[model samples]
Target: MKWLVPSAFMAVLGVTIAHSLVWGALICPFFIFAWVRYRPSMKIIAICVGVCAIFMALTSVALSGHESHLTGEEQRLPLRLAQPFKIKGQTATTTATTVKGESILVKVYLQDEHIPQLIASNSPAWCYWKGELERPSTARNPHSFNYRTYLWNQNTHWIFTLSNADDFTQCQPIQLTIREKLDQIRQQGMNHLKVVFPEKLQPIAKSLLFGDRSDIEGELLESYQQLGVIHLLAISGMHVGLMVGLLWWCLLRIGLTKEKVRIVILVLMPLYAIMTGASPPVVRAVSVVMAVIACTMIVKRITLIQALCLSIIVQLMINPVLLLHVGFQLSYAISLSLVLSAARILSAKSWLESVFIVTVVAQLGALPILLWHFHEVSFMAFVTNLLYIPIFTLFLLPSLFLLYLFSFFLPNVTFLLAGMLEKSVLLLDTFSMFLSTFPFATVVFGKPSHVLSFFYIIALFYMFSRWESRAPFKAIIFLLIVLCFDWFSSRFNPFGSVLFIDVGQGDSILIDLPWGNGTYLIDTGGAVQFGPQENQFSVGKDIVWPVLKARGITAVDAVILTHGDWDHIGGTLDLIDYIEIGEVWISPSSYEKETMEELVMKLQNKFIPVQEKLAPFSWAAGNAYFELLYPHDRDYEGNDDSLVIWAKFGGLTWLFTGDVEEKGEQELLSRYSLKSDVLKVGHHGSHTSTSQEFLTKVSPTYAIISAGVNNRYNHPHPEVTQRITEQGAVMLGTYSHGAIEYRFRGDKGTFQWMIP
Candidate 1:
C-alpha cells in the first residue's frame, strides 16, 4: 500500500512520455517524494520506491514509442486500374461512414488477418493497407479532438482508404481460433440486440453491452455529456457491481453460502471482462472486484484502500497506457476519493443526504482533470446524477441487459421489454435536454493552463486533508473565486478579435468588438448534395453553433449576407434557429433573386428585421464601427453584388471583400479610399479575383484566404499568390493553416494559427 502512490505516478509518467520524453517526468518525482515524506513511518521506503518507479516508467515509455515496423518492410507500388488487388484473410468490421461519394471509412484490413497472429502483434499492423500507409489526421485547432493521439492509444497509427470497390478484386474470409470465434460470436450478439431494440434505445444498449457508440446521434450524446451521468452509459464499475449484486442475490435464493457466491463471482469476472472487450474502465472494475474477493478469501479482512491499490497495480501491469485515458483517471480518482471519505458521507442523516455528499465528493475529486480535458464544467451535474444514477444504473441498465439475454430464448417477448426500455430512455433524454437548456448549465472556460490545474489540484487535496480547519477552507474558497474571475476576464474582457474559420470550400468569419459589445457573423458555409442519400452536414449546426455556445454567445448583433450562394447563405437559417439575430443586411439587387426573396420572407416571418436595398452607411457599435463599402447606390447582380465591408478598430483597418471579383474590386478602388492593414482575399483567392492592380492599391499587410484542403478547384491560384506576394503581404490560407485568428488591442496586435 505504501508503494501505491509512486506506482500510480509512474504509470502516468510512462504514458505521458510514450511519444517523446519530457524533462518534467524526471523532475516530478522530487515533488512526489516531498509529499510522501509527511507520513513518518514510510518516509525512506517511499523515496526508494519512487526512484525505482521513475526509472521503470522511463524504460517503459522508451519501448512504447518505438516504431512498430521497419520502413523497408512496407510495400509500395503504383496502383493501376487493371491490376487486381487481392485481400486475403481480411475481415471488414462496422459499416462504413461515407465521407463523400466513393470515400468511406470502414474497418477494412488490407494487412494479415490471421486472428492469432493479429492478436499477438504489438501494434495494429494488421489493420493497415498493403500499399503505402498514410498517417491519421491530428487536431490542430483549439478545442478540437486529437485524432492522432486517440488512435495511438489504441495501437493504431495508419488507416486504410479505398477509392471504391474497384480497388479490390477479391477478398478471403478471416481465419479465427476458438477464442477469436467466441469474440466474433459476442459481436454478433450485440448486432442482434441492436436489431431487437427500438431505434432510440439501440445506442444505449450497444454502449452498455459492447461499448459501440457509432450510431448515437450527436445532439443526444451532447445532452448526456452535459448531464454528467454519461458515465452510467459506459460499462464500468457501476455496471459490474450491479451484475455481481444480481448474481449474489440469485445464489443466495438458491441457498448458497456467501463464500461460495464470492468464489463464483471471481470465476465469472474474467468472462465478463472478455465480453465487454476489456476496455480500461472495464478491466479496472473487474480487477478491483477480483482484488476485493481475493483479499476476503486469503487475508480474511481488507480495507477499501488496500483493495483499490492492488487493483491499480494489477491494471497498470497489464496495460500502462490506461493511465493516459481520461476515463481511467476519473474512475480511479472518484473511487479512491469515495473510499477515503466514505465514513463522512455515510454518516449523513438521510439516504438523500448521503447521496448528495457522495456525489459532491466524487465531483470535487474529479473537477481538476475534468476541467483540463473537457474545457467546460457542468454546474448542476451533481443534481442530475442523483436523478440519472438510480434510473439508469439501478433499473434501466439491468432491465435492458436482462431483456437482451432473454431475447435469445423467448424472442417474442423482446418487443414488449424494448418498448418499456425505450420509453424510459426517452424520458431521461428529455429531462437531460431540459436541464441543459438552463442558463449557465455548463461553463466553458477553454483549456486551463497546466500551472493553474496543478494549483487547483493542490488546493483541493489541502482542503480535503484540512476539512475541519476554518482557515484552509476559506483559502480554498478564495482560490475558486479567483479562478472563476480569471476565466471571465479571459473571454469577455475588452479586446477585439477576428476568427477566419475553416468551413471547407465556403466562407464564414466571426468578428467580435472589444468589451463584448457586438458579435457579427459574415457568412455561413453549406453543403450541397443531390439525388438519394443527400449529404446532411450544416456548417451552422455542427461548426458555427458549437463555437458560439462554447463562448457563451446567445445573440448575434448582426449577420451580413455576402450573396445568395448556397455556400454563403446555406447555414444562415440554421444559425438563426439556434441564436437570436438582431438584423440582416443585404445588397440593393438582392430581391431580384428568388433565393434572396425567400430568405427575406423567412426572416420577416420570424419577426427579425431585414434591411434590403440598404444604402452605404457607417455606424458606431463599440470601441470600433463598420462602414459598408461596395454596392453603394448601384444595383448589381451575381458576384459583383457581393457586399464589401470595412471595419476599423484599435488603429487597424480590416477590409472584408466577399466573393467579389476583378470588376467589383475596380469599383471599390475607384470609388473609395480602401487601404487596410488586413484584407480578406477575394473569391477564395481565385485567379479571376485579387488582381495585381487591386493588390497594389490595397497593399494590405496581411492577406487571408479561406478554402478547403485539396479542393477540386485548387484555390489560392498561383497568379493570385504572385500578386499578393508582389504587394509584400503575408498570406494565410485555411487549407494549410486551419483557422487563423488575430487579437487586436490599441496599437499592437498578435496573430496565431489554429495549428500552431
Candidate 2:
C-alpha cells in the first residue's frame, strides 16, 4: 500500500510495457486501472502514466524518422555511425584515448574538412568516408566520387584520417598516445611487485587497481572462478561495501559521533565510487545504501522493502535503459534477495547452516534470472562460494587495504603485505584449479526459449515461496517435472546439431547432442598478444562465458587444443579452471616445451588426463561418433602438427583441420583419403591449406571459414575461395555470416547454413 513499493512495482511494470510495445500494441487500460487502484487521491500517478504514453509516442516518432530517411529498396540503412575519418593534405596530430579490445578512440587533426562546418551540418554524423574524394565539384553529386555508406547508429565521434587523398582512401592511421608517466609508474609497480610477490600475484594486483588484466593470464583467472573468489578481482558492491564499512568503523573508533560519522561516510562513499568510475552496479548499490540510511534518519518507520523499491525507482528515473542491462538487474536482484532472506538466515546457529542458508537463498533468487539470461547453471557454485567467501572477506580484502595503506608511507610494508596476499591468492587459485578439474563439476544447459525460462522461474518461485501449502513436496514435484520435460524435450532440441562458433579468425566449435550428454568444445578462440593494448583475455571471460552459460553447458567433455598457436589455445587456459574439462588433447609437436611443460604441470595438479598424438581415438555419445585423424607421431612443426578430427552422425561427416598449412595438407593427402559432408576450412582459408587436391579429395558439400572482418592478412584468399567454389562447395564465412550450423537428417543429408 506504500507509495515507494507501488512506485517500484510501476517502474518494473514500465520495463515490461516497453518490451511488450516492441512486439505488440501497448495496453493502456492496465496502467489506468493501476493508477486508480493504487493511488486514489494522487493526480500525479495519472500524469506519470500520461508521460509514459508520451515517451512511447516519441519512440514511435523516432522509428518513423529513421524509416523516412531510408532509401527505397533498402533492406537496412547504410549509415556509417562511428568511423575513422581523415582529410587529405594535412599533417594530423593524433592521440588515442580509451583502448577497448581491438578498438581505440583516436583524435586527429586534418585539413580541407572543416571541422566546425561538419559538426554544424551534421554531415559526418551518419556518413563515413575516407578523405580521399576531391571536394565534390557540384552539390548534386554528393556521392559521385564519394562512397556514401550507411551504419547502424550515429553515437560516436568521427575519427579523422590524415593522408593524401589517394592514399587516405585506402588506408587510415589510428595514432596511439604515449602515456610515458603512467607507463613508467606501472612498470615500476610491476617490477617491485614481481620481486616481492609470487609470479601469479602480480597480475591480480594489476587487474585490481588499473583494470589491466593482460598479465592475469587465463589459467589464473579460471582458478579464481573455480575457487569462487573471482569477485575479489573486480571492484564490485562487496568491495565498495567493505570500503564503506571500514571507513565507518575507523571513524567510530576515532570517537566521531554517529551523526557526524554518517555524514562523513555519505561524502566519502561517492568519492570512492567516482574514483572507481562508478559503474552501474556500484552506483546502484551506493544509491540504495544512501536511500536506506536517509530513510532511517528522516522517515523513521520505512521498511527495507520500501527502501529497496525506492532505490530501484530512483535508479530507473536516472537511467531508464538500466532495465535492459544484465549487471544492473543482477545487482539489484541479488541485493534485494539478501535483504529479504537475511532474517531467516540469521535464525540459524551453525556456521554451515548460515552458509548454506545464504547460498541457497541467493542462488534461488538469482537462479531464474541467471537461467533466463544465461542458459547454464553452476551446480558447484554453492560449494565454491562456501569455501572462498570467507577467504575473500578475511584475506583478500584486508591484504588489499594493508597494501594500499602502506604503499605511500611505508613502501617496504606494502611489499610485505603484497607478499602475504600473493601467497593466499596462489593457494586459493590452486584449490579452485584442482576443484574445477573434477569430472562433472559443472553442468551446461543450452539456452532455452523465453517462454520455457519464464515457466522455469515461475515453478521455482511457487516452490520457494510456498504459494502452495505443501511447499517442500510441491517444489520437489515441480523440479522433477521440469527435469522430466527437459529430458524428453532435449531429444528434439534443434541446437543438438554441431555449431561452428564464429570466434573471429579463431577455431571454436561446439557439438551438442540430443541426449544432453556429448562432447561440447573443440578449440577456444584466442588472439595474439602483440602488446598490453591488444589483449582479448577479458573478452574471453566476459563474452565467451556468458554465451556458454546461456546455452546451459557448464562442462566440456574434452577441450581439443589442436595446436599451440595463440588463436587456437588462447582461451583454453581460462576454460580449464572455470568449466569442468574432462581431458585436453593436443599435438605434442605444436607447442614450445616450456609452455607445454607449464600446461602439463597445471593439468597434472588438477588430475586432468592429457592425451597427445594417440592416433585413431574414437568417442561416441548418443547418435554421434568422433575420431581423431591426424598427428600420427607428433614429429612435425607449425601447421603440420595441426590436429585433424573427423565426426560423423546419421550418415553425415564433418572434418576439423587445425591451421594445417600446405605441408600438412600434402602429408594428409599422402596418408589419408579425405571426405566429409562439411569441412571447417583450415587456417581460415589461407592458400597454404585447403589445397586444390585436398578439396578435390574431401569433396565437401559445405565449407566454413572462420575469419575476422577486414583482417590485415586478407584471409580466405580469393584463390582459395575460387578453389572451393570450383569443387562445388558452398563456403560460409564467420566474418560474413555470424555462426554456421550443420544439422544431419538421416535420409535428407546435411542441412548447413549461417544462423542469423
Candidate 3:
C-alpha cells in the first residue's frame, strides 16, 4: 500500500507520455541513487523496480491496440450501444450523440441514423455501422483543445459519422440490464430537472445535480472562469463532503454505531458516484472520503495524507486513464494540499481567518497546474473565493441540492424551492459578472516548460509549509522572478510574427507586433448554412478566440474587413463581442450593404467607429507600418474590389491582397512597384488571380495560399502553381500546413507550420 500510490501514478504518467522515454529514464536514476544511499536489500530494490516496470508495461499493452482497433482496413465492426441513444448536444443542423459501451467513446453524428430509430424501438441494441472509423480530431493550433487526447483518455479512440440511414449494417436489440436501466433513469432525471426548473435556473440545477453543463450560457460561464470561482460550478469534493456530513449526522441520531454509519455511507457514496456519471473528480473524492471512514472504523491512526494516497491508488487501479484527466489531477492536488496543511491552517483564531488561509493554500497548490493547463492565473481568486465560498456553500449549494432531492422524491415542493433558488442564482451570477469586469482579475502567462512548472510546485509547497513559522520571503521573490521572466518573454520579445490562421477556405490573419504595442487582425473567418435550420457558426468564437486567449491577446488595435463577403465578415460581430476592438476598417465594396450596415451599427453601439473607404494611407506604430494599396479611386463589386494592404516590419515587407483577382492585380502593378518578400497569394490561388505578369512583378520569395483541405473548389490552381514555381517562389498553403507563422528580427526571419 505504501508503494502502491507512487507506482500506480508513475505508471499512468508513463502510459500518457508513452511516446517519450525520457521520463522513465530520469526516474530510474533517482530510484537507483536512493537504493544505494539507503542500502536497501537487493531483493527489495529489485521487487520495487519490477513492480513499477510491470505496471507500466500493463498500461502500455492496454492502450496499444486502441488505435489499431479502429484502423487496419476494418470496414465493418460490431459496437454495442451503451444505453438508449440519447441526444448529447444538438444544434439546429446537427446532433452530437455519444455511444459509449465496452470502454469506448464513439461520437455518432446523425443527420438520420437508423441506430437511433432502432434504439427508440428497442432500448438495447448491438449494431454495426458501415463506415471507416475516423480518429478523433487533434488540435492543429496553439492553445486549442485536443479532442483526440481527451477522447483517448476517456477510452474513446474513434468517431463514426452516419450521414444517412443506410449506414447501419446490422441491428439487434437485447434485453436491458439493471445497470442500463439505471443509466436510463439517470438520463431521464436530467431531462426532468430541465423541464421542472425555470429558464434562468435550469443550467444551475443541471450542473449542480447532474454535472451537465451543455445548457449554460457561454458568457456567464466565462465570467465565472475569469472570476476564478468556476469551481463552484463543478460537482466535486465539496458537494460530497456536504452529503456525507448530512448523512453522518442523521444516521448517528438514528442510533447507528460509528462503524455501521461509516459502512452505510461508503456503500451509498459509490451509488451516488455512478448516478453522477462517475466523473474522475467525483470518484476520486468519494474514494478519499471512504478511505478516511474505513481508517476511522478500523481504529487505525492514519493521517489524512495516507488516506489520500490510498484513495489515489484505488482510483488508479479502477481506471488508469483517469490520471490523464485535468479534473482528477486538480482534485487530488488541492485535496492533498489541504490534508498536508489543514492542521496549521485551521489553527487560525477566527473562522474567517481560517477560510482565508484555506483559500490561499488551495490557490497556491493549484497554481502550477492551472498555469500549465490554462496559461493564466486569477490573481483575484483568493478574494473572490473568500466572498463567494460562503454564499455558494452555505446557501446556494444546500438550496440547489434540496431542490434536486425534492424534485425527484417529492415533486410537489420542487416549484417553491426552485423559485426561491432562482433569485439567489441570478444574484450570484450578477456578482460574478461584476467581479470579472475588474481590471487584471485574471493574468495571462505563457505556457510554462515542464522543468519550470515542476520547480514552481516545489517552491510553492515549501513556502506554504513554512509560511506560518519563519517568513518565506525568498520563495515569494523566486516566484515573482519566474513570473516576470515569463511575462517579459511573452510581452517584450523583439521578434514580431504574422500568423495566417487556418479558418478553412476563408481568411484571417493576425499581425503581432514586438514589445506589446498592439495586434492587428485582417478578416474574421465565417461559415453560413442556408436551409430550414439556418444554423451559423463563427470562426471568431471557435477558432480566433482560443488562439488569442492562449497567447494572452486581450485587445485588438485594428480590425480590417477585407470586403463585405460573408466568408470574410461574418465573424466580425462575434469577435467584437468576445474581445475589445479599437477601430474597425472596411474597404470600398459595391456589394449589398444590409449585413455590413448591421455589423457597423453593432460596433457603433459599443462606441467603436467604423471607417469606410479607407483611401491609400500609411500608419506607423510599434516599429512597423501598413499602407493601404488598392481601391484607389476605383470601386468594383465582389473579389476585384478586395482590400489590399502592404506592411513593412523587422527588415521584411509583406503584402496582403484580400481575394483580389487578375484585373485588380494588373491595375496594382500598373500603379506601383509590387515587390515584396512575402505575398499572400490572391483569391486563394484561383486561376482568376495571381496572373503570370503579376507574379513576375511581385517576385516574392514565398507565396502563401489559404484554402480548405479537400474543398469543393480545387484551390491553388495548377496553372497558378506552375506560374509560382516558374518564378522560383516557394508556396505554402493553409490546406496542408494548418496555421502558418513567420517570425522576423533584423534581416532574418523563420517560418513555422503549426500542424506540419
Q: For this target, which candidate reaches the highest lDDT against the unseen true structure?
A: 3
Clashing pairs in 3: none
Q: Which tens-of-lDDT digit does each residue in 652-736 have in candidate 2?
A: 7888998988877787788777889888999998878888888988999988898876777899899999999889988888777
The global C-alpha lDDT for each of the candidates, from Candidate 1 onward, is 0.71, 0.61, 0.75
**Model 3 stretches with alpha carbons more than 4 Å out:** 1-55, 72-77, 86-122, 166-170, 175-181, 527-537, 588-592, 612-615, 619-625, 634-636, 649-652, 712-718, 725-728
Candidate 1 lDDT over 1-756, as tens digits, reads 556555555545544555335434544644566557665456655564564566457547644663434233334212211111222234343211111211212334534445324322212111223443456676544556677777666555554443233223333233455545556566667769867888888878888887666556666777777777777778888888888888989999999999999899999898788778777778778888887788788865656676776777666666666667898889888888787763644467977777777887788888877776776678788898877787877688788889987888877788777887799778877877888777767766656655666666666666666653435567568568756754765457777778887777888888877777788989877654432232245677767766665455667888888877767777778777567899987777676688778878898899999875443778787678788887865575767778898888867889998899999899898888888999999889999899888888888999999988889899989999888887889999888898788878765779888764
TM-score against native, each model:
0.84, 0.64, 0.88
- Who is ahead in lDDT, 1 or 3? 3
Sorted by TM-score (best first), the order is: 3, 1, 2
- The number of the candidate with the highest TM-score is 3
Worst 10 residues of 3 by lDDT: 91-100
Residue 437 alpha-carbon offset, candidate 1, angstroms: 3.1
